[model samples]
Target: MQTQLNKHDMSSIKATIPHYTDVFNLTNTSRPSETDFRADIKETMVKYVTFLRKNDAPFFLSMFPIHYVNNNSLDFDFAFMDNRSSHKVNDGNATYTNAFEFLYDSCHWALAKANATSVKIVIGAIGWPTDSYPGANVANAERFYKTFLPFIASGKGTPMRPNQTINVFLNNLSDENRLFLDLGSFQRHWGIYKFNGEPKYRIDFSGKGRDLYPSTAKGVIFMPNRWCVFNGNLDDPGKVEYMKSLACSESDCSSLDLGGSCENLTYVEKVSYAFNRYFQTKGQASQTSDDKCHMGGLGKVVPNDPSNGKCEFPVEILSAENVIEGATFGASGSSRDRVHGRMSLSAGLLALTVLWMIL
Candidate 1:
């Protein structure tokens, strides 16, 4: 897979091996002619994926999308590369809107080119991160992953080729990763193994894995500097301790002032690194909840016990039936109560059984 830069700069690392997959590190500044870069991409396409079409040998290619940009993502398209995308990629001028635009456009262009030559290509590594970003929310993440990510894996092709699933492995969840020395591409990933390094998204393709091989080919496309650590070895206990203390607390959180320090970064940071909505929005006051009785925006939420002035979410109003039929994410907190009730009943039944045995 290629780690091509954004629309402005298209200088991709030329592939050395004809059979092996390589990373492409995308994201460049403005250019006079991005068309030339597009040409470069096409030329490479003609040489590699198309060139080896005659060979019967089975091979796989994979990639990672460090940048996944879309405000709504409903009409997201990959034609933004040269602004040939079907959607309104441009607002007014030549719009190089976000990094993910390149990815989406490049995907379409590459596949179409391959088709022109009757070349067969296997799609790989498409997914959405399931955490908050500067602008993205948990709802969007869940929607994107649960619906869109699976759509990629399901392959939106013909019914006969239903088994021919495309590959879209997620980051942070698939492999055993390590903390790098932060020597290259973009940022440093200190806790690469955020647990077992399991893939953020999992796919069950009914035993057919493009032959169904269970592994991702690459990540962040071409960004070597994306998530590597430096100097203080992560394996070092003292270093980890100092890093955590300096990074987590407010007293020594000055590291944030610097362009690249993990100071003040949270676990949530690792979950959704480049998302737009990860940071809290400006001017929006946090929900300063005092026992729920507050002005719901402009109107006052009158409490049932008016003297206490403490309002609660109308649990009785939001019944299990209401949640199941009306809620965006199926039955809300009521499921917890349902489980508790079931457990209580089961416990009572067990107690009666013991009493019967004693009698």
Candidate 2:
């Protein structure tokens, strides 16, 4: 008699638990970025997956993201938006800029090495914070839930990983039951639930799971997390002291250039700032345009309208000011329809007003 998983047993050849792995340390890890631990685990899993698929055995794997760690330590000298950049700090942390690419490569390599088709991988943790951090307010938390959870959910099957769902897990369901968000060497507030035990109202990952138990329990939906709230103020004196060794050099401050422009995200505001010696076009203070968004590149501009779709100004002719509205994860730019964008001040005001009225 042979075990159903007998054929897939690389156990004889493979390493097992703790395995010096970040097993119990989903929020913490030996590696600072996704780079340190690459395909070793995936390659090992791939072998098992291939064996299982060939032998016709069911296999399930849980994948927790380096959600809290990036290639660089959180930089305070930089503005908030500089979170994306490609440079690396002397410390092990990867810069947020190059971090995404690193994540993509590692995941892709693992999937490929796993040579796995039948084996399923689920992204067991992920999310964004609602408040700015510290206050840990419910409204901010809820607003983030509104956007973050769904974004992770929406990113379910990447263009490459289609058919491979990275099921995110529900909040507070941490296998280790870690109530705290323990990012590697960084301060974190990454749980979706309040310290007091109330759930943020935005995401339904867990509640929906009561119905979804069978599917996810069996590996259908992937990557479900309530939220991750990391709010160490760039100005936080504590972080400066705590994360000093992880800090960048004066040459590598925030993602800003010597003149403060996003090499990739450079927009009219930065451009305008450079040329005019001030941050404005004519008399209007402009909203900084984010790199990922393109409202309508000049193609939509009419003959006299001037925006020739090249993003170059039409030479100040017959102009209404361009209101750079920042980036959105989706086209509508409406918080109601998308995930991962900042909330409007009006909405904040409305939420406050409602709270005031309710109180």
- Maximum-TM-score candidate: 1
| Tens-digit per-residue lDDT, 60-116, candidate 2 | 333222232322243321211123333433324333232322343344444344565
After superposing candidate 1 on the true structure, give the runs of residues whose Cα lies further than 4 Å from its correct spot: 1-37, 56-108, 111-116, 130-140, 153-155, 158-165, 172-359
lDDT of 1 by residue, 48-161 (tens): 555344432222333323233332342343312223335433422334433333343343334444543244334334333322222222233333343344345455532213
Off by over 4 Å in 2: 1-46, 55-105, 127-144, 151-156, 162-166, 173-190, 195-197, 204-359
Error of 1 at 76 (Å): 8.9
